[model samples]
Target: MSRRRPRASFAIGTVKVRAGHAREVGLPITRLVTGADVSLPVHVVHGRDDGPTVWINAAIHGDEVIGVEVIRRVLTKVSPKTIRGTLLAVPIVNVLGFMNGDRYLPDRRDLNRSFPGSARGSLAGRIANLLMTEVVAKCEVGIDMHTGSDRRSNLPQIRCDVDDPHTLDLARAFGAPVIFHAKLRDGSLRYAARERGARVLLFEGGEAWRFDEWAIEAGVRGVLRVLAHLGMIEPVEDEPPPLSLICRRSGWVRARRTGILQMEANLGQVVTDDERLGGLSDSFGRRLRLVRANRAGVVIGRTEAPLVNRGDALIHIAEIEQENETPGQAELAEPSE
Candidate 1:
């Protein structure tokens, strides 16, 4: 007869959640200007059986709030009672920046770049340290959710170390429209988690500060799919998952002449080299320059802001083979500058 593994308790900060239950705990951050203590809220769901522990975190960049809605919807569909593992969900990580609708901490430091930080460091660093110690250290897998920066929109995509077999499998199971071979950025949460022996998948979709229904729905579905792949939940057979287009490299098309930018390309559009993507025109309706594709690729991201300056990134394209590239064997590209 097979033996069942013993159920374990999940603890973070001062709260402890045992098997087959869910709990919400607040991890203290620094105080505000008004001396009010701010805390990072976490929802933990611990299943009755033993399985892989996973964490889903959102709002590392406070302005990219679509992930918050995605996490909420995902939690609504998940319960600890019938699952086989623990799920840690943190809908808001940067409380200070989230409250102000800003992208960076009050100290102007980017929280994403302050990972595995020190307790005696800056505000962002301290928060990073807290998350690494209290949340990330306890998980074997993680999914960090994000949307594009302000004035930009991204197609639903999974970005991860595609060369790693296990990480690549999770990325494929996520079923995003695109799978990007994104390398770890210095000091980023993915990098830190990987250093601590955890495999992480970064999900990028929609735009900052606003919830896009398609992106949110895709994200919710993808998280559930990953959980199912991890044996934490039953498979969701809603629809056949989309085939992920793998991209080795991506480049940004920048505006040549500063003017009112009119983009002709959109997310998910395929373009060839020298294809006209847009035209820049002045306020008087005189065309200054025409933007063309520098390489053959599909549009994965684009700027929404009509007004642009010289060298401003106007479109993002991911380079993929028209044919012959197999899944899990695609080449990787260098991290974007």
Candidate 2:
């Protein structure tokens, strides 16, 4: 007879979860004006065997709801008994903003800009502090999910500090259509998590406040790939993943003139420098300005709204190496609205 290995116990906030089981834990934030308590809900899956602990959190920005579904699907596919390490998933991190359907808290502060927060500070600060202490501190690796802000939509992409070998490995393992070297902004969760000795990957996909099936599927698969790369669970597929285009630099092309903008290129499309990307024209079809690509690159993000103002960002392009050129089918035939 084989001897059974001892199971581990994982605790967060006031909740405790034993190995081979799952539990929902709530980290209290603050009460609403109506006297209702708002808490950050976290789902924990502790594996029987010890390995690397990974934390996957979504909706740090409340309006980015696609990650909520991504997290849900990931949880449904993951079983605690088969995993080797703990999985801490917080689908909704900003409960106040999530409830209000706003990007920022009622106090009008961006939670992503208030990381490593103070306990006695503003609302965003307090929530950030709580997450840093309770969730991020306990994990070895983290995935922060996000979507394009305002009226913009993104091609499913992975953004991380590729300079870090460990983070770069996870980014490539994620198998997104593209991977860009994104610098960390001060006070952002990625920055805070890195400072705490955890490698982090930031995934940007689809648009805010709506679900994109393609983006959601990509997100779920990418996360599972990372987990398998960490030996937390079995791989979803035995075959090698499709190659991901890696870009070291990217920039946005803003509307040169305010008008009704018409795009000639779609997201994930590759264009050469000086190629016509779009045109801004008046309602009567009088061309006001012809938008051209400033440099040769792949379109990773673009605004969905037809109406535009001068200086408004219209297309985001990332410069990739020749060897990492994207396949023709990787480009979308139509823009995602």
Candidate 3:
């Protein structure tokens, strides 16, 4: 009987580390619809030795620019020579949206919702199709980065379905505080990735079209921790921040009446029942509505749009069982790295 060598799943192609041409390790899926020949940038790292493969991506929503910065730092700092198995990093997915500084593509389609994509569909759908077919179908794991839209800010969090133990493992390993354990939306990248037999963790932080230093630091460190956990690199201490607990349920506290808005509770602030989140007022300074937390939990997301309709979501809250789970005095010895 002849013995055969085990195949490396990420060894789909060789990465080009040359000048001008950037890198094109993976096979070309499709040329983007730009007037110029400039296409999406993809860097595939298939290490000489076999290990796990994790693809980290950012800017699915073009307005969410912090992840783009995060991926840039991660790619530049993570030497492929030191990487073990493989790391496929795509800093920007929605090129058109990013260029226009809009949340959706020119076609008004959300790329995140258009995935696992269609080759013969709209522009965003085509890009989604490319990612689903070419990149995601070949990866073992993934990390999709995101942020809150408009003036609303998100304290760094991992949002995913916690029903599966394996998915939970990856989420924990990713090491972001405050997880929103919720059901997967139909067309989200998480559902698409899961359909492709890979578990992906979505990191939500900061605000769209803005930069938050702490959120960016949390994102970059979380990616590094995930990479370390996947055995792509040796484990290194990150001086982990306060690891907020998992939140199983969340919803929005809508504006009770229409008027000018002033927010009280901030992102990541735990709110007890009946606590005021914010208050709405008329142009004449008369109070219109007082936003209150219906349940006790942390504020995961909110809307920054000052003008609001009666039913518009103003404050998004996540209900958690462990409201008091922050790192204690004994655990805060100069913040271990």
- Give the winner by TM-score: 2
Of candidates 2 and 1, the better by lDDT? 2
Which 10 residues in a row give candidate 3 its minimum summed lDDT?
A: 328-337
Candidate 1 local lDDT, 223-261, one digit each (tens): 999999999999886674556888879999999999998
Ranking the candidates on lDDT from highest down gives: 2, 1, 3
Q: Score each candidate by Cα lDDT.
A: 0.88, 0.89, 0.75
**Candidate 3 regions off by >4 Å?**
1-34, 238-242, 327-337
lDDT of 2 by residue, 191-290 (tens): 9999999999999999999898888988998999999999999999897666788889988999988999988877778788988988999999999999
Clash count, one per candidate: 0, 0, 2
- Predicted structure 3: lDDT: 0.75
Where does candidate 2 stray beyond 4 Å?
325-337
The local lDDT score (0 to 100) that residue 132 gets in candidate 1 is 95
Q: After superposition, how far is residue 181 of candidate 1 from its true place, in Å?
A: 0.9
Clash-forming residue pairs, model 2: none
